[model samples]
Target chain A: MKKKVLTKEDILHLAKLSNLKLSDEEIEKYLKQLEETVEYVKNLDELKTDKVSPTSQTTNLTDVYFADGETNERGLKLKEKYFIVKRIM
Target chain B: MNLHGKSLLELKQLVIEKKISEKELNQYFLKRIRKFNPKLNAFITVLENNQLGIPYGAKDMFCTKGIRTTAASKVLDNFVPPYESTVTKKLQEAGMSVLGKTNMDAWAHGASTETSDYGVSKNPWDNKRYPGGSSGGSAAAISAYLVPAAIGTDTGGSIRHPSAWCGVIGLKPTYGRVSRYGVIAMGSSWDCPGPMTLNVEDNAYLLKQIAGKDKYDATSSSIAVQDYTNEIKKNKKFKIGIAESYFAGIDDQIKKHVYKSIDVLKKLGHAVKPIKLLPPKYSISVYTILQRAEVSSNLGRYDGIRYGNDRNFFGQEAKRRIMLGTYTLSYGYYDAFYKNAQKVRSIIIENFKSVFKDVDLIVGPNTPVTALNIGEFEKYPFYGELMDQLNEPASTAGIPDLSIPVGLDSNNLPIGFQIMGNYFEEANILNLAYQFEKETDFFGVIKKGINNYKD
Candidate 1:
């Protein structure tokens, strides 16, 4: 697996996108630190992952215990409106 | 009369038995807060100032109507919530007093509390050394005897690690064990709020009061929590398992103290067995990756547009996670990094499952290093990176973990042992710690250099 080296420009763009207004002093320091962290994460590319279906969840969790529109006994009864857990599938 | 070093169990006993009133104890902490919090930087907002008139939980991170909820970030520095967290409501109903809110890493990012926009929380033991973070404020306050107990959230050892550095007890309950409805989110999946206290029994007792099902959190488990305090009292003889893998190359001073304590456990009619838990090295990588990935998702709400100061709001550390997480979860890199890490996480969980079959409980040296100086990690954003090495293994598996101060080092800083239990088996872990507390005055260790502490 080829290691993806993050260029200085790439680091700056990411930093900007993340809304990190890096001072002149922080740029050089973060360039190297971010490079190391990026490389640390990029090391995962060495693993074989072709056949696997990407899963974003650790468990196959469902709200079977606590049904929607109908509340269970966990203080949801205290208020008329409650926020539902939005599952991102 | 000496409240600074009293355990929660001891303090609660005094409160319940009328030896001391809860109001009096609350007043004592309120006085200490006024005296020392200025020097310690342990609080950001200190809602209700000294006391909650009635007693509100401190921690500016917790949202309460008319109270500021900064999450320690300057972005949402003035933001206050219209509602209170379930824990706070429960504490209010129980007549528990909240001294004042403690400080932390802005947005719960670092290991030491230095990242807080407010200022660093000084270790109560030695003002020079740091109290661990992002829950450092809570740990420092509890350790300094400002408050008998306080609540902090744990994600990648935030609660437990801080407790160890400050020489107190910290608990990270099973994932989804506590509701995350009101507390600001750090890493959504891993964020869990638990207690930090002066001893194991106090942590256990507070945990019982807070642990329950929450309807707001779909991830919150429906399992019933046992009376953890009572569970600790049963079965004097216990099967305590020690992690040989985690101990392989820990600092000799900490390793020596842990093993010596194991000897004491053996003498107490309990069996300490060497268990083959997975090596802890990859967990740092695995956890940092997963938590960063969740950081991308969880912190997205803080666009400074809707929530916190998105533009100039977060600290350097928060920005680092946002960039790292967004990069990892970006268009092309998901499979190798984020996806593969979860599989590795599964393998780690499987290892925990296999080990639990043989050992009744698991133990290891809690942190790779003890309390460090305030500015130690100023150059590097990841403060105390090595100490985080051992904590993530159990955290990734969603198992309950406890860190208790076992003894002090040559420098007299507290050394802690991390104990883990089967998923949702916090009662057993508390029992083992309670038994150890009975045998040794574990909470008896004093803040050695307090008289000479400096700003």
Candidate 2:
């Protein structure tokens, strides 16, 4: 497998997808480091994993429950609810 | 007399025995922090409110209601959480007083606290060198005797690396063995909250307090939490394995000192033998893919809304990792990179399972070398990741790994004797570490005080 080199455009697209804006210098830094990182990770391709099962997490739990929402003293319903972000106009 | 050299477990006992009030204990640690923190840069925040008990420092990443939880990032610098983390809450419930928040790698991304937006946490031993991190500040606090113990979260050697460098005890409990509830997420599956302390007994006692299931975190283990304190006191002997591969890339002095510690274990009635183990380098690749993927996804929630500043608030290390993660988990590359890494993760876990079948625990060096001087990242961009090479496999496998002082290198930097046990085998590892600690005097040697820090 040919190791993929991450181009500046690739990183720019990644930054966009990741919701991050990068400066020209940051882009240059990522270009070199990310390219090297990708190359290093290419070693995974060497192992034959066609029949292997992926271990995304070791916990093996499913259907995690969250508490029911209730209105706090502030008159807003709360319970696992994150702070509301300002809407982008 | 100053309480700086005492173990937290010992201090807690004194508090219970009425030898000292919790308020007095708090004052002793608070005074030490005030004196040493300017030199060590170990603390991010020092709380004024005091409670009577064993004072424990928390890594800034763990959310504490009304107190700042920065995760050492500029994004969350002003953010004060409305709730406490489950682990810290348990500590509070168990009578451990919160001293303050310690420094860490920004978002716990890098191994060194140098990545923290606040300031680099200095090594307590040698001010010129790094304290080894993401949990560097926690380890440094314990090393400097600012606090007897501190809570640290480890994903890829965050707790263990700094423990090794700072010359203290670092225990990375089995994944899910401790709750992640209210912890600022970095890698969801891999992040584990553990203890860094001056002695093994304190590490065990602290683990006992925090290890249990939590309704808030579904990933937390439902397994029965062991009486780790009592477990450590039990006399036990078993087979110990030392893998040649774990020592391959480390410095000669570290390798030599670790072997000397292994010999101490042998003298204590445990059989030590060389065992064939999987190449840990493979874990570097898997950890790189999964951690980066998770980092990108986890940090996605930071949009200057509910908590921190916008995406623009990330540091270079965080952005670098985020970009790489986004690229790897991107549409076309998902199967080849992200999926393949997970598949390989199973192989790494299987490798540990096979090894654990023969040995009660595996022993090795915690890092490739002792803590390097600052500016290491400039010379080698991957210094943190590469330094963590030996310890990452056990982490990726979700097993418990403990690092204790083996000996010091030629430069006087500490070498760590790493003992990795099977999943849910934290007590086994702690027992061996405790036995080793009882037999050795390395802990006292380190506490003699660094020559450079003027008292």
Count of backbone clashes, every candidate in sequence? 5, 4
Predicted candidate 2 versus true structure: per-residue lDDT over A1-89, tens digit per residue: 86557667898899899988888988888888888888888888888899999997775667766547732332334447765545589
TM-score of each: 0.89, 0.94
Cα lDDT tens digits for candidate 1, B141-247:
87777666789988888888988888888899988777777888887777888988766667787888778877777777778989987888897566778777887
Model 2 lDDT per residue over B98-130, tens place: 798999988987877888999999988888889
Clashing pairs in 2: B22-B52, B22-B53, B111-B133, B111-B134
Off by over 4 Å in 1: A1-4, A16-20, A23-27, A41-60, A68-89, B1-23, B48-57, B378-382, B446-455
Give the per-residue lDDT of model 1 (tens digit) for A10-60.
668777666567776767766666677766554444544455444334334
Worst 10 residues of 2 chain B by lDDT: B446-455
Candidates' DockQ values? 0.29, 0.56
Give lDDT: candidate 2, residue B343.
96
Best by DockQ: 2
lDDT of 1: 0.75
lDDT value, residue B328 of candidate 1: 74
lDDT over C-alpha atoms for residue B80 of model 2: 95
The alpha-carbon deviation from the true structure for residue B453 of candidate 2, after best TM-score superposition, in angstroms, is 6.9
